[model samples]
Target: MTNVLIGVDLGGTSTKLAFIDENGHFLNKWEIETDKRDSGKYILLNIVNSISEKVKELKIEREQLIGIGIGVPGPVNFETGLVYQCVNLGWGETQVKEILEKETGIPVVVDNDANVAAIGEMWKGAGKGTKNMICVTLGTGIGGGVIMDGNIVHGVKGAGGEIGHIVSVMNDGFTCNCGKKGCLETVASASGISRLAIEAVRKTKRDSKLKEWYEKRNQLTAKDVFDALHEGDQLAEEIVENVTKYLGVALANIGSLLNPEKIVIGGGVSAAGNALLAPLNHYFNQYTFSTVRISTMLVLATLGNDAGVIGGAYLAKTYGDHIRKIKHNSYIKELT
Candidate 1:
């Protein structure tokens, strides 16, 4: 029987599941609302039941599912498969791998959500064919993953690629949810960009469209700021410059250290396309090392919402390959 890979991407609002073949094509993809009741105790149960139902509907046998790879929004301890303090999912010290494998009766691989997204982009998205790359997602907050030589760099505690918490601000800065102040997330994230725009509207004396926006809507979004910038709004330009300046410093530090081939930018903010890339690149060139400036390139993520699931499938595929290799070796040794 042909084997299939189950890919799961766990999010705060919904859980995405997909059936992918060994070739990395999606045989089927669907979603289910996440049940966060009881501190997310139902999350995995819901996934397990859904998988059972989907498999029956698709007429796939249980043995066809070689394995499952999942991405979650938290720091994972690879040794124990425990997820720590994932604020979005209301999780604290949960044994993700153990629970999922026990319920599904198949191998399971767990990793930080951002790390999987990076793996997806490298495997099939903008950074395709590149073994060395970094991925940064600019969503409500920032999430990042670093990859080198075709493998994710999971540090001792499996927190290797945390790019958002880099301390970009040394002086007075807004507090981050991580209980740290002056993080790059305070200034470079979508929420952070809007916060900066609001502060400018209140403090700056100059007449600006963003001031009118804040006066009318009583709030602003990163999209609004970028839209105004497209129309040549002076205030939007200054705000974006400040935001990208902080991003530049953080990226430059990372770039100088790893010298990755491509740095992929993904998430909602990347929808601004060249509008965001132009300024970010300008600042990046300024702060980056001379050699890295010419070599490392920045590009927007092409996969969008599918990055996580694709990454999860890749993990399952590789795991299956490893298992087959071991079985082959065992059979050969018995014959000998």
Candidate 2:
């Protein structure tokens, strides 16, 4: 029988679960709505119940499972499996690993969601065959993970590789969700790109395709901006230039500091493909130091929504057994 791992990606609105074998193949995957009532107390119960059902449905024996790995949308202590302050989930400090292990009678591992996504990419996606890289997810908000020397950099506060929170505009910039001004997320994420388009239309009377689309739809999307740019709209080009400039500078700074082998851009904005990467690369090359410019490559993320779960599975396969042994020893010692 093949040993399998369970990977969980816990988000504010929903949670994704995957069963992956030792060889990195996903055997099954599913999702469930996140029940945040009572400060997310029911979330774990739901997950455990779902996993039990899946195990029975698949006719998999408990002994055939290696362990479970989880990715949470907050800071996580890898050793303790404790999550700190996930505002979207309305969760404060909590012991995720201990509770889950006790409930399921299986070993558990946990880490930051973005960090797991980076690991997933490194293991089998865009960053494959590379040891050092960065993964940046440009969705509703920006998230980032840095992998160095074949390991995820989990800073003391679990805030390592927070590329999106990097300051981009120094002055007169829109506030970010993190309560800061001019964060890269404010200008580079999908929503941010749309916000920039709206601001441009209101501030200038530029004749552009975006204005007509906005007037008709009453809103614009990052895709709309890219479409306009592809159609040779001057205003759209300017907006893209503005967004990419910030991203380029931010990425260049990251390159200067970490000198990563690759930077994988993922999320909805990346779907723009070359339209997003072309100018972003131009600016990245322009701002990057000459010595490192030739070494770093910027590419799109290939794993998409599966990155987190895949990474979680990898974590379980790598660290779950060792952690479980350590915990068992500690418990025995305490009892004796």
Candidate 3:
């Protein structure tokens, strides 16, 4: 029987699962809607049932599965597998690892989603071959992970890499979801870029392609801003400049602290490609200390949406041995 790992990425809207081998090769992958009904009480049951069905479909014996690794959309206690909170999933203070293990009879490990994604990138994506790195995901909001000497830094409250909440605008800044103002997320995320673009059009008389695009579409996106910038619209260029400046400065601040070997940018906004990286790199260099700038390379993340599941798989493989040891001890205790 081949040893396999089950990797789960639990999100607000959907849950992605994968079967992977010891060598980090994915055998199969699938997704299911997250049932947040009843405060997400059924989410783990759904995952356990789905894994059982998938194991039967793959003709893999249950014993052949070494363990399960799951990434949750909020802070997690790695040792206890407890999720602190997942506002999107309507979950609060849940014992994920214990419940899943009891239901499925499989050892389980859990971590914060962003941290797992960083692990995935380090194992197979842009950060491959680097031991120290930071991955920043710029989607609706920003998420980040910091890795040093090949291990994730889970701070006292498991919020070590919550880089988005870092204050960027000290005064007169927009309020963030966390209720603070001037966060980097307020100025650099996709939504932030669009918000800035709208404000710019409303306040300035500058002629911009984005202004026309927004007029016709009735809204703007980060992509629209980048498209306009590429078309030589000065206003769009200014918006991009402003957004990247915040991101670059924030990352430079992180660089000063961790001095990681690589800073990888991912998520929806990174699709702007070089249009985003050029100015970001410029500002990153300008703000970062010389030694930090010389050693660290800022790059784009390559794993895309698969990063979470892939990272979960890597976690299962890396931690399976320890999980097995714990299970064996428990069994011996029960026998005694």
Candidate 4:
């Protein structure tokens, strides 16, 4: 028996897929730019065809494959296998599970990508061996995943852990995609960081290399801010510091509520590395309760872009019976 599971990470920009054995070893991996012109159905059909072709090429028997799991960059009804909304891809109320199962003739499971990323990090990345953890993906928008007692926490609506939507600032806020003001992501995400940099340069009348850089590069991005920071540019450094402070405040809020064993930071902006992490850590320490004997570790995510794919595999392997057993074991231990 092949006992192998396939994991797919469906992102707006790229689609990543991987096949993994029971031991979490990758049997194969690949990525392709997402076909946005196709509707959700056609895109899924392509995935089905790709998987079938791969199986034939590898000479792997259909019976050997265990199951298929997908992680999508939007809200999903995990219990019913329906996507609530995929605004990034212009998808609405998609029945992904039914379509994938019909096309592939295999059991299909799906969840929000951020939730699966938490599973990935918990399984093989920074949160390894920790039963309780959270992952914050600091991309164009912040995405968060909650893992409590070793399982993904999907509340009544499967919209749990949407920390970005959480409000941290009430005024002087940028409008968010969700039509909210002062949303955490609007201030701390990569896009937010760049916006701050641009506004600072324009408002402060401060001497910054950013204007020259933007003239040369055509557009300013968070990467430019990091580069400027590296060059010891004062304005860029101040913007970074402010961004980190806001991010740390959000982290402290999350920490206070969940008190997770660790918080794993991921995504492109996290590429700022120590320059971002150090200041965020400092702010988190300053804001969070000091006498609570808190010991949550903050660390950078290790799985990178592969986290969603690997996490989807882990979810496929354990979402049903295995997850239930683990939860039961935890409850029993608490009772004992």
Top-lDDT structure, candidate number = 2
Q: 1 or 2: which has the higher TM-score?
A: 1
Model 2: per-residue lDDT, tens digit, 1-336? 989899999999999999999888999999999999998889989999999999999999999888898999888888789998788888999899999999999889999999999999999899999999999999888999999998899988888978889999999989998899999999999999999999998787877899999989999999999999989999999999999999999999899888899999998899999999999999999999987699999999999999999999999988866776898999999999
Residue range with the least summed lDDT across 10 consecutive positions in model 1: 77-86
Q: What TM-score does candidate 2 reach?
A: 0.94
Candidate 2, backbone clash total:
0
Can you give the lDDT of residue 267 in candidate 3? 90
TM-scores, one per candidate: 0.97, 0.94, 0.95, 0.92
Residues 34-118, candidate 3, lDDT per residue (tens digit)? 9999999999999999999999998998778988889998999998899999999989999999999899887888999989999
**Tens-digit lDDT string for candidate 1 (62-143):** 8899899899988997556678767888888898999999998998888899999999998889999999999999998999
Per candidate, the number of residue pairs that clash is 0, 0, 0, 0
Candidate 4, pairs of clashing residues:
none
**In model 2, which regions exceed 4 Å deviation?**
321-336
By TM-score, the best candidate is: 1
Superposed Cα deviation of residue 138, candidate 1 (Å): 0.9
For candidate 4, which ten residues in a row score worst on lDDT?
A: 286-295
Q: Which RMSD values do the candidates have, in order?
A: 1.2, 3.0, 2.6, 4.7
Could you tell me which residue pairs clash in candidate 3?
A: none
